[model samples]
Structure formats: C-alpha cells, structure tokens
Target: MKSTLKDPEPLLETQWPADPVKPRKAGWGGLKRRLAPYGFVSPTVILMFVLMLVPIVMVIGYSFMNNVIMTKHPKFVGLDNYVTILTDSVFHTALANTLAFTFASVAAHIVLGLLFAMLLNSPLLGTRFKALFRAVYVLPWLFTVAIIAVLWRLLLDPNGVINFLLMNAGIIDSKIEWLSSPGTALFAVTFINIWAGYPFYMVSILAGLQGIPKDLYEAATVDGANNFQRFLHVTLPQLKPIIISMAMLDLIWTSQQFALIWMTTGGGPINVTEMLSTYTYKLAFSQYQFSLASAAAVVILLLSMILAFFYIRHQKARD
Candidate 1:
C-alpha cells in the first residue's frame, strides 16, 4: 500500500512570481506602422478634395442652374443651360475652331518635335553642343504662355517685324493681317501654340531616343536599312510609346489652351479663333452666364476625354 500510494504536492509551496517583463501593448509605433501609407497619402488626398473635387462638383452643380454673376442665388433650370449651349451657333463655331486648333497644333508638335529629337540624338554632334542645343530648344517652354502670346502678337502685327522682314525679303509686297482676318487668325494662333508647345515633345521624344539601345540600330544596319528606312521602321517603332503619350498630352493641352489665345487674339474677328476655354471664360465672366460657362466647361472636358480615349486606343492597336 505504501509503494502504491502517491503523495499530493502542496499547491502554495511552489508559488511563482508574475512575469517581470510586462506584455508590450500595441503603442504609437505599432499603430503608426499600420497607418504609415495612409499618413503619407493624406496630404495629396486632402489637396485633391479641396482643389479638384470641390471645384468639379461645384461646376457640375452650377451647370444645372440658371446661375449668373448678378444673382446672389442660383435658380435650378434642369439642363436648360446645357440645351442652350448645345444649340448655340457660337458654341458650334468654338467647337470647330477648337478641334482644328488641337489637331493642327498637336500634329505640328509631334512632327517637329520628333524631327528635332532625332537631330539632337545624332552622334555627329558633341555632347556639350547637344546639351546647348537642347537648352536652346527648351527655352520656348520656359516662357510663360502670356509672354509667348504677347511676343508673337507683336511679331504677327500688321506693321510688325515679320511683315517688315517679309517685305524686305520680297516674300510679300504688302503686310498681311495675320491676327485680324478670320481666315488667318485661327492658324496664326495655332502656329504660335505649335512653336511654344513643340519643345515638350522634343524633350520627351529625346529621352525616348536616348533610351533606345545602340544594339537595335546596329541590328537594323546589319539588315541593310538605310537612314530613311531606319527612321521609318526602327526609330518610329521604338518611339511608339513615347509618341502616343506625348500626342495625347499635346491634344489635351492644345484643346484647353486659354491664356495664349486670349492674350493673342481675344477670340476676335467674329469668334473665329474661339476655343471652348475662351468661350467658357467669356460666358462666365464677360456675359456673366455662370451656368452656361459651366456647361461649356463640362462639354470640353467630356470631348477631350473621349477623343483622347479613341486616339490612344487607335495608336495602341496600330502598334
């Protein structure tokens, strides 16, 4: 019985102290670790809400009303402003002018930019010279839109340096009304815009060009591709992505251009050079028709997005 029996241990005899090191609670550090990304993005989010979203929401709301500068309160008109804008002949003309300006300016920018990029990428030039030329090319981009507009306005004036040069050079017998006539006004503004904007394309395209491997050019040369052939097949194909993106950006920018056109032509000569942006500004400020201006702005935004969408899709598909 003594051998088989087991003694009961005293429960309180071997009492142990509680853990000397307390369990670590999730403190500020742990919480911050979890929320770090959100904290980093909070400023951008707040700015977007305040600057972009609020303005866009206000514009959309105003588009549905009969809002004017004269009235303290907006009267809800339920799409009447949109209807009027859509039916207005001035809006139609502005739309057409905008389309033409965007297309022409973007086209010229792409062509001239790519050409300049190619020239700058040439191995014949020294690196320092290339840098100098690149700076020279990009100088136009540094000029403010208003400055460019004013400078070109003077150059394009009937009695300006351009006409003087043309007359002296025997290119024309008399001065041309570059910014006054309806026929030339749109093109004149477009030309100035193209000159100012092409540098963006040049810089972007040059970056793309520099990124292309020399091995690819060597491979093309081994295949007996001539200079023109290399440009068409190798250079263009390699630069497709950059070209597409630059073209899209140029389209959007040129379509939305207000300052240059406003300062240069002021949408003059029967609104011949009036783009949607100019029209919107005039509607809101000059005419005091806030609702119509908002509607016009919305239309411009929608049209720009739609056209950019299709143009990008087409380019990607072509590639």
Candidate 2:
C-alpha cells in the first residue's frame, strides 16, 4: 500500500497565494441604515411636538399666570387660577355632568355594540342580511359630528318626528323639550353620542369575534354548554381585553365631548349639559378669563393622562 502511489500533495500546504482580506470601514451606508427608521418617523415627531406638546406647555404656563392673553403683561400668580377654578360652583356642576354623560354613553355603547356584533357574527343570518344590517348600524358613524348634532337637534325638537312618534305610541301625552329642557338636555346629548359611537365598538368587536377559534366553541358545546353558558365562560373571557381597551378609550373621548353638546344644548337650560370642555370654552371666549380656562384645561389634561397611563399599563401587562 505504501508503494501504490505517491502521496497526494498536502492540501493545506498547497494553498494558492491571494490578496489579504480588508475589514469594512464604517461609512455613510451603515449610518444611513441606522438612521432610516428615525428619518421615517421624524415628521410625525416634529408635528406632535409643535401641535400637541407646545400648546400643552403654553397652556400649563398660562394656568399658573393671571389674565393671560387678555393682558399685555400677564402676572405669574402660581396656582391662583387653578385655585379659583377648583373652587367655582359651575366647575363642580360641569364635572358632575361630564361624569354622568361619559358613564351612560360608555355603558350603553358597550351593551349595544356587543349585541349588534354578536348578531352580525351569528350563523343564522344570511350574508346579504348581515351586510344590510352592518350598513344600517354604521350609518351614524359615517356622519361628521357637526352633521350628527344638527340631525339630532332637528329630531329631538319638541314638534319633531320623535315626539310625534312617542305621542302616537302612547309613550307620552305631551311633547318633551328634549334639548331645550334642563331635565332632558343631558340625556338627549348622551343618547346622541351613544348612537354615534356604538358602531366603532361593533366593528372592533366583530373583528375580534371572527378571530376567535371555532374549536373552543365546539369543545364547549361538546361539554354540554348552552349558548348563554358558552358566552359567559368562553366569549366573555376571550373579549375581556378588547372590552377593557375600548371602554378606557371611550371614557377619554366621551369625557372630552363638546361639539355635540354645544351645538344641541349650548350647555344651556341652567347648565344641565355643561361639560369640562364647554366650561373651559365659555371661560376663555365668553368671559375672557383665559387664565381660568387654561387652568380648567390643565385639569382635564391631567385626568386624560391618568387614564392614558392606565391604558398603557394594561397594554404592557397584556403583552
């Protein structure tokens, strides 16, 4: 075996000569790649700073001063404006009304939205019927807030179609001044808001429902669970996270609602429908109390921030 053939040349020793490999230099390409994401988002960052953060900062400064915008030389009173707003009776009334309006709207939105979503997701409905129902239910959402306000004002007029219908149905004997009456203004506006907002929840919930696995429902059925029981144990549990998120968002939005109330009731009839937003608006524009208005606005912002913090914490926990 030793004499059979000359040993093959050692592979390692027979390597061909070549140029030495050079390391890549740090260059514009690497830097560009690193900066690409930030470049893409820079416009949004700039806009938020200018539109949101700057105004917020200016408002906060005004909140601590006296006679801002009204006077050439505004004095820094250091919380006097805040103290004045906090002690005002009208502010208390506005806060209470805001809470009630928000609570009712959000609760009703959840219930109605969930019901409509379940109906839309049902197996019993034909595709055409489901489509028709979806279109009808989402009509309110398609209208702008201004349009909604105008439409509702007409509909809720004492001599309008709603009153006629109610009278015909024997629900009431006399026409109710819904938006004009202090007793009914808050209710009317809250109802209008609820109608406008439910479709958002319905669409979101329907998407969530569609994403749920059929196997879970099937397994529940096999275990002798009925519709109600299955909904209680499976559907509710699956939807818990989405419901919480929507509710929190609704609370923030409903708390800040102003346009509809302003257009419909103008926070009138003894301030029954006055909200934080309307209150601040009147103080700044009508009363020319810019400092006090800024203070009220700052309070609202703090409340919104607290709600946002909870929402973010919830999202992190979910992740």
Candidate 3:
C-alpha cells in the first residue's frame, strides 16, 4: 500500500491502429499474375486451330486444282477454272440469282424480324405467351426441307389452295403457274425462306432486347424521347451485333436452300432459280461431269470464302 504512492502519470495509453490502405506493394509474383488469364484461353485457341485451321487449309488446297472421282490425283489448273467460271454466262446467271436471293431474303428477314421482335418485345407482353406464339412461328424451321418442299408444292399447285382461292375470288380466270415461271419461281422460294428464317432472328433479337439496360429507356423517355426515337437511338445500336451476325447466318442458310428450290422449281423452265448447290449437284450427279463438278465446287468454295471474308471484314470495320 505504501509503495503504491508513485506518480499517477506513469501509465501510458499507447494506441496501435491498423495500417492504412495505400498502393499495393508489388514483386515478382505480380508479374506472373498478368499471365493468369492465358491459362483459361489456351484451350479455346488450340481447339480453334485444330477445327478451323485444318479444314480451311484443305479447302484452299482443293480450290487450286482439279480432280475427278476416277482420278487419284488432282491436277493443277492454274486458275483456269476461275477465269472460265467467272466468264461463264450460265455461271454468271447462277451467281446473280444467288446474290439476289441472298440479299432479298436477308433483307426481308431483317425487316420482318425487327417488326415481329418489336411486337413481341413490347412491354407487358407475357413470356409464356410470347414463347407459345414463337413455337408456332418456328415450326417451319423444324420441318424437313424436302418435306416442306413437297408440302408447298401441293399448296402452290395450279389447283392447290392458293390458286384455288385466287381463282374463286376472280383474281384470275386462269390458274397462274406459281412455280413454273422464272420470275415468280424465285420470289416463291424466297418467300418460303423468309417465313422459315425470320423467326430465328425474331427470337434471338428478342433476347437481345431483354439484355438491354431498361434504365436507359427510362432515362430516354424522361428526356422526352418518343417510342420511334427511343427505338432508333437505343434499340438498333444495341442489337447491331445480333443483326450483323444474323445477316451472315442468313447468307449461309440462304446459300444452302437446295430442296426448296429444287422441288419447287427444279432450277425451272430456264435455270432461273438454280443456286450453286443445285448447279453442282446437277453437274456431278445428273450430268456426270465429275471433274467439271469438282471445278465448279472449287469456284463455289472461293465465292463462299469471299462472301465470308467480306462479312468478317465488315464486322471488324464496324468494331
């Protein structure tokens, strides 16, 4: 008790606080940290090289030479086929038809798809209801194209439902051959393609619409943007990726419209709707010109590659 009579200020209340957050100290480990992302990406790169690179090489090699089914070796033609095919009047016609079909179908699908998407994407629309409607819309996509062709052939027959309706309405006294004429046949095929394909774009673009930030639209409306302006400024820019991608997809799909055109018009009374696929098929199987067919295939390959290349370039340019 007596020893406790020391100075009361002897005890100190020293406080130890946490270290403040500052710039992180760096070292060798941080250097390798930048490389961590590569590990995840390496597998994708390898798969791409294996799947895409090897096939492209094979196609390029096949494009340079000519081969027949009977021959073991494909002889080098030195671009003669390219020159000839380019100058060929029939080839030119086929190419022109293909171009027209591709552009028209793609454009139609874009327009129709946007319209449908707008309707479907409208506010207060029920998801299950929209999906139910879309199920009906996408039925054409699931039908066998050959079966579809046969079905349409029956539907568009001179005495078929369409012509019958038109005739009974006194639209025409005589049944117009729907697929027999060159001009009408192409349009007919394009119609089927549009009906089948537009739904794909519609559903995909509806999804794209869903992903858009809703607040942007709210802010836009608050700024006095009307429906049309909101769509032009907001929706189109956001869906640009989907539009371009779908356009390319359309190109690929419309290019392969074989059974539809073949069954509907069978390259027609004048080869009017003859696309490259049908042309090659006729050449190889029907005409039995194996080498020439191969040559034509090579040409088709190059044209396809050219189209694909331009699309990719366009995408990159947009980017």
Ranking by lDDT: 2, 1, 3
Better of 2 and 3 by TM-score: 2
Per residue, candidate 2 scores C-alpha lDDT tens digits across 1-319 of 5588887986777668898899899799999999999999999999999999999999999999889888999888998998899999999999999999999999999999999999999999999999999999999999999999989888989989999999999999999999988888888898999999999999999999998999999999999999999999999999999999999999999999989889988998899999999999999999999999999999999999999999999989999
Query: Clashing pairs in model 2?
Result: none
Runs in model 2 deviating more than 4 A are 1-24
lDDT of all predictions: 0.89, 0.94, 0.80
Best by TM-score: 2
| Stretches > 4 Å off in candidate 1 | 1-29, 126-132, 307-319
Between candidates 1 and 3, the one scoring higher on lDDT is 1
lDDT tens readout by residue for model 3, 25-120: 777788679777997898998999899877666655654567545567878777765576667787777878888888999999999888888877
Evaluated at residue 117, the lDDT of candidate 2 is 99
Model 3 segments more than 4 A misplaced: 1-67, 70-78, 124-132, 311-319
Please give, for residues 1-319, the per-residue lDDT of candidate 1 as tens digits: 4587678876777668886997899999999999999999999999999999999898988899887556787688998999999999999999899899999998999999998998899999999999999999999999998889889989999999999999999999988999999889988998999899999899899999999898988999999999989888888898988888778777777888888888988998899998889899999899888889999988887888897887879777878
Q: List clash counts for every candidate, in order.
A: 0, 0, 0
- CA shift at 48, candidate 2, in angstroms? 1.3
Top lDDT: which candidate number? 2
